[model samples]
Target: MPTPTPWYARIPPPLIMLFAIVVFVAVMTYVLPAGHYERIEVAGRMRVVPGSYGTVDSTPIGILQLFRAFPEGYKVATPIIFICLASALMFAILKATRTIENAVGRLLYKLGTKRAELILVLLTFFYGLLGIMVGYENNIAMIPIGAVVVLALGGDLVLAAGVSAGGMTVAFGLSPINPYTVGIGHEIAELPLFSGAGLRSVLCFGALAITAAFNVRYFRKIRRAPETAIGRGLDERGLALAKPLDEYAVSGRDWLLLALFGDGLAWVLYGVFNLGWFINDISAVFLVVFVVMAACSGLSLSQISAAGMKGIAEMAPATFIIGMAATVKVLLEQGQIQDTISYGLAQALQGLPTYLSAVGMSIGQSGLNLLIPSGSGQALATLPVMIPLGEALGLSRQVSILAFQVGDGVTNLFNPSLGGLVAMLSLCRVPFDRWLRFVLPLTGIILVWAWLGLLVAVAIGYS
Candidate 1:
């Protein structure tokens, strides 16, 4: 018999967590004094002044303001939610036509059992490369597809998220061409653009390879022991889609759908690479695919409409979860306590030795991610102080950026406040505690990886 879910875990974790965090942040607005730092425009973005912290008029979230956070969070989360709904609709159409089942069936048939482990590894590497190529936030839309793929493969959503978001987290955080943290870090440090690429490239690839292996191992474990699945009362819809090897048959229609999927992705990638497309733009492209695939599968207009709505309905709760996470950031910003917290965290690193200071900078960056989820925002807000501090402690500018890159990326893997991470988990129906249970050890391993990398950089006087 399946273990009964605890009373506390019965309510969806995001709703409970959102309520708790919303109230907690609201209370904090009153408890923590409101303050901010001076900002000066540089290259079209405002950069924070390191020592210009000053008290501001307190704007605590009273009862009225506290209640307003949800709508505001929805507002902040709307664009990503839209993208998610659109992608879900597309996948729903595929599911309605059994396109996904056939594709996975063909894959399992072709790969056989021995080579099946490579699926998770390849997907992790592919998504990690997407993280490096396009940018991280934009890839949140792809999480659903990854979920469906893994679900059809009979793996749970925890592994789904581990493959999709985990790949992005490791590679995007350490990407040499990140253009957000590393890019802005270089700008603030007045270094050449994308300088010190060798070390970061090595770290990114090494981390990606390690993450791929981790996810593959997890997949194999659950395949062997179904009782070990992390998602409680796990949805079994996907597991039923896979047919036995003897029943495998890949038809012409399945081949057509496969080509269409590849074609849609290629178009989206082109837009991301050359057209500067973001979430809304990607959704438009997917909506087009949603239409094309429906027409190709001989889905009637009524059938298309029904499948599309079903998909959106299936994803509706996930949209709210994304908003709830976004709400945490919105409330923090509204409280005007963001800078205060940033300044406070930065202040703690003042007297640490060079190596520990490097580690501290990463830790501060990780903690600060909860407050300022954006990579560029974090680099702008914290690098001014961290850079000089690292230099004063005899570490180089590149090393400072490395710490920011790793720290900024690490917390993102598990931070509930991050909409992208939360969006992925909610889409997969994996609770936050479950994610922590699965990822904490990996997070620790990566954290130590960053610390050791920083130690080596400082020891060799890496520039």
Candidate 2:
């Protein structure tokens, strides 16, 4: 076994990426623009610009210079800040009402199963399927509760965490209706919102189905594996970081939750009906829902503000990590890195025939997802390059779409930089090594499922 690094030497993925960005920026000062490159346009649901890069300027200065130019990177990180604040407030409110705990308790009690291994598999399926409708952030909030369920069932904590993490990724990965990232992928690839919906839905459903089957097999092994298989007994130290289950109010909180749920419904309707309310300003919808939750919860303005602040604090680390990720976007934009990657991969697979391009694309997309954890951002960077290549190679737009979704969703299972993944890890106190041991097999299973979906897509006129 590889020796684990000491605590002090363990570097977070965001920090490692940031260091790479700094080095890339420093080097770009000398050899970019003059080197082989392409003019890139970044258009997606979200965009990340390193302050070090000039605003569409033709200047030759390194993007690193822009970092110094804008010292308050927080200004550039506004969305991240808002997201963090909202998550923390949501968590606080959920805790204050004990609604989450009560809900989880009820779920476990109703399960009426003595075999924990069976329940864990079922939980993964439920959560993963629910994710098709809700965002990963919403679904991940329930993971810690899943941990308690696991502990009670005598299953491994790490395995339970994997169930949540892995399940959530498979759900979002295969979702035909991901309003954020998939929407961005469609826009960048110039596919209609309804363009590949049928095939995409099929692929998504297929991935989830296969994921469900594989998790069942894996958890069976987990149930049989001795507790000693886990190096350190599952640590519940971070349970302290979570508000007590009783703190979340359930009865009076229903109205608040219902309102929030309705708000979420309205948001979904706006997407489906193409409502002008959503078209004019989507952010306004999030704000309105937030306010409604406060009002229904009977929270005073001060209490709400305090909750929001707490939520922001909890999410502060994520904010910095996401902001640093923006710097990597800067490097790719300036260096034509996306094009370079696309071209190199395309050339290497040139002799494999057209069907293979879709395969290569799926692999490339999965790999890029590691370096750029955000699906929206990755799609924006790669789709234009990949879609056109796929078209030229006689592949359908649907294949590109399915390929992108599968690639984006699979890597999400363990990427530490992703807000939901990191939050689940923290909330559950599952260490990186432990998370890996449990998830790697499942991830491999999902990867095979992804390719199988791609092959099906090819067979069904997608290629």
Candidate 3:
């Protein structure tokens, strides 16, 4: 047999991004004229200006000036790094206490032997709910469990990989509670905090159902008929069944119970009783609660601190990716590339029909999503351009919001700019190819679903 490929040979997302950035800068600087764009105010004076974008000098002078003039921009790295460290430390402590393994085992056992289809569907739905409640950044640790489930059932690894990544992609893209992208989009569109929740939730659920069905069909094919005559091993499948708690002395049930109750109570109070404190900033709250749980679970101050540090260490690469992406944003702003792209798209497509502009604005925002990476950042950058265009086209603010919601959420399924996506990859040990295999088809399905949903929303007088 040929030698197995080394892990690092896989797609190097950061390096590829660097190349793209260089090419973008080269095209924007050398070929494009300085006066290619005109200053334009967007969304009732949102401070957006076009022309002279991506102007950072490729020379040493420009490089030196960047660090000297805008030291504050680099500070954006702090929060990402801090949060990651805290998460790593927390998970490590949980691992040491055996709570993480125990919790997963209990979950698998409770799931029990039943209709495999139902289990898969329920698991997919759980992923969507987790996205809404926990945020995608924190839920990636569950992928190994997903893999174990697939293998345990004698399911195909490819099918298992698809379901695991696909479910996450849908949840993340349609995140109900994520303030980063969806929240920013709503703000730019001037919609309420919970605006588009009805439609967004429905889309998330619909995507989950569609993905579960696809995985189930694939699983059946693998189960009923074996394509290869070679022996199919079951080592990976047995992980969930193995007694992981035996390795660690303590399971920390009380601590886990508290964590679950705390999480549940927070969600209930926020969603049902209108407790603003819990929902207003859930991520911060989650961090606090998990930290407390670590301490209360019989961990010493040193252990808790160490666990937090480890969590942050795990997040370092993700933090770097986010920081680099942000740097590109700064470059875009300086070079006036963002506005130029926005205005150019608007001006070039100005002659298109009215509804086309509405749809195009959404599509345009999605295109920006690839570059901006952060949903919130993209919304802040692009929504100013799109919302007004929507208004000029006689589309309602709601339509504008819906378009953004769909566009912003859908593309993160595979975008490397997303820290959560990287976290998911690390947790699952799923390669980009494996992730894409499962996600591409589901992405197409959701893309069509979003368009149809937009049409339906318009027909129902949302606009």
Candidate 4:
């Protein structure tokens, strides 16, 4: 009999997939006609005029340019890359101080095993809230701590992933302030940034509620019958690491560190919402918080630098993946084929009813997300085309952005191209197949909810 390849060996790494995408897009530059839309300034923002797409001189990216796309993409992706690196470093320093572990351990001790379900609900909601304010890629750094907490509380790896990374992915899709998705999405659509926040915030909470309920149900199932648990096959090392709740007391210094973190988070929210902060501002907030926390924890400058560097090193692959994903956009733009694809999609949508067109836009964006997983990158690549398409189909730009919110955000839960989610699952030691089994149904439900949300937006002439 022929030997079977291990699942891990069979799946190519994310970078390889991204490289393949680069080659594919380079080929597309030759096969697809080059085109562009006429842009006009609208209240200081540039937007594509509907019905202005025209074939342009072919600007096919040569093989050499395709090779150079990595550096070019890195330049475009630098802001997001730095933000992720800084957030990872901040959390790394927190881990080095053992503050997070101590805090979570003490909390688990007080809550006890019987009330463990509440921990699931609370942690899920907390992570979801972070998703709304901090952005999802930034939240990946916290997943291991969440996994440890859930595991120690007698929950399995899947539950840990659910409450942390899983919950965050759900909330991120529904969030009004994700910056990467909603922020850039609104900007590209030329709507005010976070303009429909009231509706989005309500939807965010609803999605979180659904995620919490789903996680809690699975947690109970596993607790009642460990034999049937999804994580029953987890290695001995992982099982042993889930320590029993110890009597670790929170000291004055711990409280101070916690306060710093809380205040830093509040400042970030204020800066983003009130002051209109972008990626660079958010990264600076994390850097400042890390430094202040490190000083309060009595770590010397050398130790803080070491911890921060280690955090960046740990996240290096994910950071690289971000740059690589951006290459897809780079290649498409260089080839001048993005607008061509957008025009084709728009023309196809013209024949559909207005409500169906809204739904179709959401569906199309979801499909696009499979290939381009970075929310900001996808937003930059697709929203310009989708915005005009929405107008042509009698749908408002707000409705189009809403479609983007659901499509780009929700699909991340299952998209293999999403390096952050893949890294989180790896951190929790959960298999991709197992995660699919656990999340597929919830994704379906969320998609239905999203479709309904779009229909409502269209019905009310949402703008």
Candidate 5:
């Protein structure tokens, strides 16, 4: 008799999982009520009127449109897809030059395995800090570098992805100064911009501590017992084992290339913060970095072209999944139930007590993130109602915003509908099931922290 397939074999791959979900949501388009809300422009976003929801003619997507959503996802997700492909191509060319390998080798030579955990801690904090300051969607290129460093430090790809994406996810959730989420939220809630920074800073620090401690503990665990990691057989820390430290050293050319890489990133950051650059601008910078670095590394033109193609090929799986994830969003919008769901969720909070209402707002936001993953979009749609609802429940608008912050922020860590999360995990070769196993526990703990923080905010009359 043939051997049985493993239990996980029954589960669909990430791409298939997304396809199934998109189909399910497409079906629900017919089943769920269709509605819309009147909107007014505020702070460059369309804010929903608090009491303007009305039933509209049902507009469920047909089978043709359902199939069309996949291609639409590709079109809709193009910007982030560009960023993802660019990062992959750049790293592939960098690998051709052995820059990452030699850099990890030199660092290991100086730090040894025992001391490398510090690098994890610091990188996590650095990423967390950048996210706190810069918001989201600008750091896709940098995460792989952190993952590589972690892989070199004797952890599996899961841990590598964990510390890098994990830290950034946390910071994005609790970002006090983020102009997109918190700033837009503040403007919508009629609060001073960055007004509640003190409490938010504390919340962010406490959450990062929890994340860093949990990940570092796991890092130490697999260090001593590699069998225990979810990625045990799937990943390896071969930087030290691939060759002796003595055999690997950073050259003058590597240093110059490294500096150029830093300059490229600095330029991207400048464009993002100063010039309002986004995906296209950032992708252009990465492409330049790849071409320049490949030239400096002395690869022939054909070799350079091959490396770029190979990088895009390697990234195809993740890139495809990212596009499919967008299909779910497209289907949701196509059905016209997006605002109906938002209206119903808001209506449910009408009679709850102050504390429960605050918590409920966060819960509702988390649920809505499954539908509306964009922070600014969610804020515009939900906060108009949530703020007033919280005020009616004897809760401050600040508490409601905090609830939105935590609810909106933490879900990105593993929300499959959020393309960035799935894309990052796929790039790291972490399966969706394994990612949930690792992140769900932290997600639960962070939700609790969010609840407790909300309670404290209410107790102190936070405004």
Candidate 6:
């Protein structure tokens, strides 16, 4: 018999997908007509005029320049790349000091035997908040801690996955302050950063509520009938490896580190909301926190340097992935087919009713997300086009941004290409298929809610 290919092996890596997109766009510059839109400064930001798209002389990128796009993409992606690396390094230093493990161990001990459900609720909300503030990808390191807590509470790996990955997925979809999606999307749409936050906050909380309720119901069922859990068939040794709640104790030093970390997070929030800091500014804050935390934890200078390097090395793949994602935009722009694609989409939606048009935009954004999984990458690639299309259809730019946000985030739960999701699931020993099965229904429900949210935005003329 012929050998079967493993499922994981079948799914192409992000790098491969990016290379394919670059080549595809390079070919497209030869086949598709080159075009552009007229741009004008509006209130200190660039805005593409709604009716300015026009076909222009084709600007085909040679094979040489096709390779050049890689370096150019890396340059464009440097801010996000450094931010991810710096954040990972800070977390690595904290891990080297055993601060996070000891603190989570202490939390598990304090929750005791009867309050498992409370643990679930608390962790879900906590991680969701992290998703809103930092990002979903940045929280992959925390999933193992959540798994240990879930096991200590007699819950299964799926519950652990839910509290960490699932919770963050929901929050990422809805968070008003998520810089990667909402911030970038707004900037691309030429709207005020974090504008329409009041409605987004309400929607985010609603998502949290729905996720919490679902997790609680499932946790109770599994506790009653362990065999019904997704991880039921796994051997005892496998479960033991994932459950490490008894591994460490929280000392006075751990408490101090926790306090300092909390304060650092507060500083980050202040910088972002009050000072209008972007990724570069936030990376600097994390760098400062890394130095202070390393000193307070009593690490020698050499040890801190080593740990920081190790952390950066671990996250090097993620940095590469961000850079590769940027190449998609580079290829489209260089080919001059970006505006051509956008103009076609706008013309196709010309006669649709307002509500249906909003829904179509949401659906289209969702489809695009499968190919371009990075929220900021997708925003940079699509929002310029989408905003103009929305205006051409008489929809608010806010509505266009909302569609992009929900589309980019909601689909992340099931997309196999999301590196962070895959890594977290692997860490927890939860199979991808099981996660798909568990999350599919919730995804459907969320999509319905998102459509309704868009309808409301249209009805109220949200902007």
lDDT of residue 297 for candidate 4: 81
Candidate 3 total steric clashes = 16
Candidate 6's residue-wise lDDT over 22-93, tens digit each? 687789899989998887665554556666678998999998999899899889778767767777767766
How accurate locally, in lDDT, is each candidate?
A: 0.80, 0.60, 0.59, 0.78, 0.81, 0.74
* lDDT of model 5, residue 19: 76
Task: List pairs with backbone clashes in candidate 4.
Answer: none
Clashes of each: 0, 12, 16, 0, 1, 0
Q: Could you give candidate 3's per-residue lDDT for residues 1-463 as a string of tens digits?
A: 9999855356466536643663464356444433223334554434343223343333221555444423343455445544444445445555545564555555555665456778877777777776666555555445555665665555655555556766777776776656766666566566787676777677777877787887787776666777731123422422333554233332456456446535744554465336444222444544665666775678788877766675566556665555554555555555545555666666655666656665676677677676676666566565666667666767777777777777778877767656556555544445455556556676788878887777776667573
lDDT for each residue of candidate 4 in 114-188, tens digit (9 for 90 to 100): 888887899999999888766666555568778878887788888888889889999887887777777777877
Give the C-alpha miss distance for residue 227 in model 5, angstroms.
1.4
After superposition, which runs of candidate 6 have C-alpha atoms over 4 Å from their true positions? 1-9, 133-162, 176-202, 213-248, 300-306, 370-401, 412-441, 455-463
Sort the predicted structures by TM-score, highest score first: 5, 1, 4, 6, 3, 2
> Per-residue alpha-carbon lDDT of model 1 for 1-115, expressed as tens digits?
9999774355447667667877888899999999998999999989888778899999999898887888988898788888888777777777777776776666676776566
Candidate 3: stretches off by over 4 Å:
1-15, 22-74, 133-169, 175-201, 218-315, 458-461
Which residue pairs show collisions in model 5? 173-409
The estimated TM-scores of all candidates read 0.91, 0.72, 0.73, 0.83, 0.94, 0.78
Q: After superposition, how far is residue 26 of candidate 5 from its true place, in Å?
A: 1.5
Tell me which of candidates 2 and 4 scores higher on TM-score.
4
- Compared with the true structure, model 2 gives a TM-score of 0.72
- Residue range with the least summed lDDT across 10 consecutive positions in model 3: 229-238
Ten-residue stretch with the least lDDT total in model 5: 232-241
